[model samples]
Target: MQGHGYAQPVKQPPHIAWLVFLRVLFVVIGIFSIGFLTWAMMLRLAIVTRKSLDWGVFVAVLAANILSLVLLATEPGDEIHTAGGNLGITLLLGTLVAAIAYYLAADIRHFHRLHDAFTAHRSMAPAYGYPAAPSPYTATTVPSVPHTPPPMPHTPLSQPPIPAPPQRPAPARIDQVRAELDELSDYLRKQDGHHDGHHEGGR
Candidate 1:
């Protein structure tokens, strides 16, 4: 769970159908002595594949083919013409053969490089059909041990009881009645004096 997953497969570049057509033209040029067709095909393939070496080969071959053709055309006399034609044909055929060899070698090199890259990528990927091993750098969870509570201390069975607080005695009902009567009598005496003063004033 801690390790990396398998790497996704890499996508190859799209193959151009025109490049295949050029290769077919190369085969055709080998069988037929079509003048400068092989050089033309190589030039097209080089442009399609974007290979500088292929382009260079195409240029060199094209130049040789042109020079030979010019010499064959401008030479005077039958013998000189025959010799020039033969030289031109020989140079053309040799250039085509060299171009074919170069193409094959380039293809082999491309395949080998692709294979090496794929192999390196696969080697770094996680194993198939098995779970990844945990990493040493990752944190591991440890199960905690259940804690046991300590036993409670014992208490005496015959300990003395706690004493209740002392209570105050309440006043008797008769004393409460006597206090109220005294207040009532004082109020009555005041009322009587007030009536007597009012009567004297009226008189």
Candidate 2:
């Protein structure tokens, strides 16, 4: 085991972006340990290592953020308003970053798969005399018949026709109406006369 001197180089310490990713990630674990551990003073508080303290600080930061938001939302005028607000922002961004990281990790696998598929397709095209790939959704088939039409025909939209307004009822006559009114008045007068005749009959 000692004969082989070719130990793998510590995968070139992560670049700036990677470091940022790590630090951003560091918060997830940092809140639990790194936050406090980063400070030299905390080393003497307990038997905690530098690494462990940072994690606590990071976690404590998250907790503090959560606490501040809760306090701010519940009691707006709380003395720790500034601290709570800052923590709230940190918590939100950190949580978002974490979620994005989760998605990135998940999608990386798909990206790798696509890469492999592309390579495989390219490798096979020369062997089969197949046409070059255009895109994933594009059709690769060549024309079979002399006059092959487009896959789908173009057509204008068939909008529902607006209905015509209904015909209005015929207008009533003014002279006839007046005559009917007169007839009604006469009928009312006869009813009154009948009532009077009844009174006379009773007498």
Candidate 3:
């Protein structure tokens, strides 16, 4: 359902002494909400399901959001929040949130459908939030893991050993580069080189 709209955000006077205060209070809070959502979805596998389709949408939306923020931050004051740019941004965010809401709504619908089907077939009955006792002779099977591990002759069937990866050696070039950097740093120190190495460049 379309919901009631709130007051549209307005760009206040740019050079006011209070502008920094407003940024800390308002702009930072909006950014923080984005960060919170990111953390909430960090461990989710829904995006990786179906051969990484979730990743494709996630990456696309991430790129769009980044581009929007860049344009938002670098545009001239008048254009930053103008009707066209604002519409584009609003549509992008609306799609992102609506997708999530749609998934949740669809899942609820699916659960209801499942409950109904179960009732019709009498395959499973519910007792206070738990499924009622399954038929005694009905074979119970657990969900199969998405990944099938390769067999190891040394591994015991009862307890699978989790092997830690062996530590890798640092690249030879990295050590050489570190030594060269240290020599150059020492030479520069002897010459009292300007921290910026801008001896020839004029301010």
Highest lDDT among the candidates is held by which one?
1
lDDT (Cα) of model 1: 0.69
* Rank ordering of all candidates by lDDT, starting from the highest: 1, 2, 3
Reference-based lDDT, each prediction: 0.69, 0.51, 0.50
Model 1: per-residue lDDT, tens digit, 14-131? Answer: 3546445656666677547555666766675576557888788878878987876786676675565476777876777777777677765665466556667767655664546344
Better by TM-score, candidate 2 or 1: 1
List the candidate 2 regions with Cα displacement exceeding 4 Å: 1-75, 78-94, 129-203
How does candidate 2 score on lDDT? 0.51
**Residue-by-residue lDDT tens digits, candidate 3, 3-102:** 5543332222234344335324433433456432321231132432332555555555556566656555554575546765675566446644644544
- Comparing 2 with 3 on lDDT, the higher-scoring candidate is 2
Candidate 3 matches the true fold with a TM-score of 0.29
Off-target runs (Cα >4 Å) in candidate 1 are: 1-25, 33-35, 75-81, 122-203
TM-score of 1: 0.43
Worst 10 residues of 2 by lDDT: 40-49
10 residues in a row with least lDDT, candidate 1: 10-19
TM-score of each: 0.43, 0.23, 0.29
Candidate 3 segments exceeding 4 Å error: 1-52, 78-88, 106-203
